[model samples]
Target chain A: MKDKELLKLVKQAKNYDSKAFGLLYEQFVSKVYNYIYYRTGSFIEAEDLTAQTFLKAFDAIGKFDGQKASFPTWLIRIANNLTIDYFRLKGRRPEVPIEYACENCDDCNLEETVLINAMSDRVKGLISGLTDEQQQVMILKFNLHFTNNEIAKAMGKTEGSIKSLQHRALSKIRKILEEEDG
Target chain B: MDNKLENALENCITLIRNREEGIDDCLARYPNLRKSLEPLLRAALAVDEVLPEISPSMEFKKSFGAKLDAMVEDKRKKFVLPRKASRKRIPPCVSAAATKCFNNGVCNCLYLCCLRCGNDGCIRQQSSRQLTLPGKESS
Candidate 1:
């Protein structure tokens, strides 16, 4: 369905329309799951966060402002905020500086070497070197395919600032990889 | 070969690092370089790469839906939202301009309804046009 239709469904959902709510849920669950998964990096955490994101969206659907952003973007902002809240409550910070950092290697034919747990150690080691902010931007941009403007909106920063931050963050990854190569 | 390869590698790295072109643009340009450079890019990407697949669990949804239904039914607990409603509802034709009214009102039924009605008609019309054109991009 188009944004307008989805928005209509969301409105119906707010009015306690079960069918409309179901349609909206179908429309947004994947986005919510992916956003949560991207942030938390754990299927379990993503699943939990996805649930929380929707529950919150459902609770606050009545107050959603379409003028501020599209329904998907608004939902994403909600998911992102909730994930941040989860981190705050835990008092645990991520070891990686960048967020996404993916290269579509899931199809690498070397299953034993690339796919399963074989590269986990190396991957984990590389990410351990990044800073928290870098990690956030990297994941949001690379993993989730969020534009600089969207990321900036999510992070409460200007687009130019986000572009610069993204550049610096990716540069750090390049440096780390270069060092590893040597 | 290493120096010549190094120059190409630098360009490849910058492109990959910048994410400028298609993901495999450099690899396509230099097959030999691909053999040498892909591992590095792969390693760089893999580091901290978390592939959390989205589980479309119908069971989870049903259980959660049931729980929410119970809460709403049993508690009759009304939760007050953070923002106040500004404009209640606006008619369909006036919607694009009445974005202000939609934002002001807490209930979005009228606004969404109007948008949906308009979009549904527009999309239907576009589809009919595409069918006649046959070779168009099917906008």
Candidate 2:
């Protein structure tokens, strides 16, 4: 939808229009789900978090200020915060479930699924070793395809800091891969 | 790593992703940092490859939509209905006139006329006259 139309729908949704809210949900559900999936590395948790994010958004849409953030940015921030809270509640970092990853690969053949799962596990393991900020930057950059400035806005960081974070993350991942190969 | 090299590597990555520059151009631009930058770029590519796009299942979408509908319905019941009911409620005198008009089969026009006049006393007098009529007592 165009920005003008989306803004109008947002206004209607703020008035508790269920149909307008449903349209916004349809537009954002997949992006929000994929973001949480990458962060939590678990489909079940991602699904739960995505639901919570939207429910929370629906409850808070009245207070949402368009000047403060676009709808997607605001929604993604909620998802990111919920994922953090999930980690705090569990008292553990997210773990890549290789079996779950393999089972969810509907588009890949058996051989391709196995290889992709292996690579995913390894990469997730490597990323999980980084600081939370670094991991988030990498995921936003590579997985979600956000530009540095967009990631900065979503993360509440400067674009310069995002560039440094991406650089450091890549450098650390390279070191880990080298050590593993040796 | 030196800050310059780090900045250069980041710029190279951006350029390569944007198709503005190739690996050879990047390597030639920073020959002294080639070895370090190359591995980092390769790791970046590997990370990109490993990040798969997983979508929500059909069951999830269906259930979530149902759940959202229920929540919205509940919210409407809690917040919207009361406000609308309050806004549409007719005053007592107007309601009496409305009842009399209903019996005469002219309520729609009477109600619209009352709304246009915006006079409670007018509606009250109108209703009192109707009430005095013997046959209209039921109204």
Candidate 3:
């Protein structure tokens, strides 16, 4: 659904409309699930995390101010925060190592070796080398098709900061890829 | 980066944005830099294609929907259910009488028993003595 339609649902949901909330859930669960899947590369973990994300979002949606962030961005922030908390609780960072590449086998049905072979190691290696924050921005922006403004909103950073981070990340990845090819 | 590289990067960016716009259309639209940024542009174009599609399972959706319904119902029930102050409870004597008084709400029923405070004691005495009904002697 479009953002305006979603906002309408949100308004109805705020008044305690379960069907409207269900529609909102259907609209966002996949996007949120995919974002988590990209970060974790574990379907089971992604499913569990996505469930928690929506539950937390529903609980807190009453206090959400739409002026500050779009609903998707807000949902993403909640998901990102929960993923971070999960990692912190596990005493590890939430990252899928480049070596353990997965290409949504159910969607595309590509094997691990095929996925790893499809991308130049240079891109994957550089991405893996990036700081967690930078990597998240790149993944959310370039890989996941989130706008810089949306990334900024989701990450709680300024738009200018997101742009600079994206530039630096791209330059670094480009340099690494160039070096590897040279 | 030099102007050439910058222009190349800009072209790459535009191409990446329009990557989903189809290759022939992109090639026809911007013929100049497509040749230079071909590899990077191709990679960028294929990035999303390579990204796996993740779908929630039917079972998970059913369960999640059920869970969401339950949670929302639980929240709604909070408002709809009677408040503590509004809930009514019959006095134990009235409840007992209701049960013993021929199952009718009429207080004037012949079987009506109003033995309030000592009802339990009287019932216990009758039961112990095996008295079947009122005015009966344990023989």
Candidate 4:
């Protein structure tokens, strides 16, 4: 959505307009869900956190400042904070089996599915190794498809710092993979 | 981390992500930075990266939306809401905006409202919008 249109929707939402808030929820639900899904690695927990994020957003919509961050950024920030709190409260992320990540596709070949899921598990393990900010950089960029500027703004940093974080994250993953091969 | 190289890497990664450029295409854009950029770009691209696709199900969205509507309803209830009346009722006069008719005589509506008339039930019908009651000084 264009910034102008988004601004208008946010204004309405601040005024407690249900339809406008619903539109914002629909537009951002997937992105927020995916962010939590990656951090928590459990669909059920991701759903719970995603719901909490929106509920908190609805309650605090009046406090949102368009000058500070874009709506998506503010919304994502809420999801990010909730994810952090969830992990902090739980003490550790439980090791959910990779197979449980997706529903069974009866039509797909079993061998191919197992191979693909294994690869996904390995990739997620590598990403989970990065620092919270670095891992967040990766998720915001790759999964949510946020630009460097948007990520920086959401994160309260400069675009330059965001670029550096992304580079460091990818470089760290590369080194880890290389060490495994060596 | 060279600032120029970082900017180039950011642009190239964005391009690569959007399918507007490939490793070779991004490298070609910054030939001088190739040696440094190529390694990072390779790392960015090399991973067979498929993060989980476990999005919220449809049932979750429907339930959450309904919950949000309930919240909005509750907020709306907190305001000075006007409700439908069988007979047109006057706004209550308990507020400091009470008329200065302190003659110990004819009140505009309070005499009948607080004492007698059934149609004008200001003291009884109960409009919560009565923000302020008359102070002891007024009585």
Candidates' chain A TM-scores: 0.77, 0.82, 0.83, 0.84
> Model 1: per-residue lDDT, tens digit, B29-136?
878677655654454354325432333345656666676555433322243221223243455668765787766573455445544665677655644553465466
What ranges in model 4 sit over 4 Å off? Answer: A93-99, A104-119, A179-182, B46-48, B52-54, B80-139
Best by TM-score: 4
lDDT tens per residue, model 4, B57-95 = 667878998888778766755532334342236565743
CA-only RMSD, every prediction: 20.2, 9.1, 13.3, 10.8
Query: Judged by DockQ cut-offs, is candidate 4 incorrect, acceptable, medium or high?
Result: acceptable
DockQ of each: 0.05, 0.31, 0.14, 0.24
lDDT of each: 0.60, 0.79, 0.68, 0.74
Candidate 3 residue runs with Cα over 4 Å from true position = A98-126, A179-182, B1-50, B80-139
* Candidate 1, A127-173: lDDT as tens digits: 55566666666666655556666777777788767656655555566
The residue-by-residue lDDT of candidate 2 on A68-98, one tens digit each, is 7778878988898999899999998765443
- Which one wins on DockQ? 2
State TM-scores per candidate: 0.56, 0.70, 0.65, 0.74
Model 1 per-residue lDDT at B117: 69
Candidate 2, residues B1-139, lDDT tens digits: the string is 5677777767877788788988788778988888777888788877777776556776788789888977887898789989999868878999899788787778556766656675688885665564476765655
Docking class of 2: acceptable
* Candidate 3 local lDDT, A1-182, one digit each (tens): 67788788999787667888888888888888877766765667778999999899888879988898988899999999988887889898755543343455454335544754455344355556666787777668655578767999999999778766755666666566567679
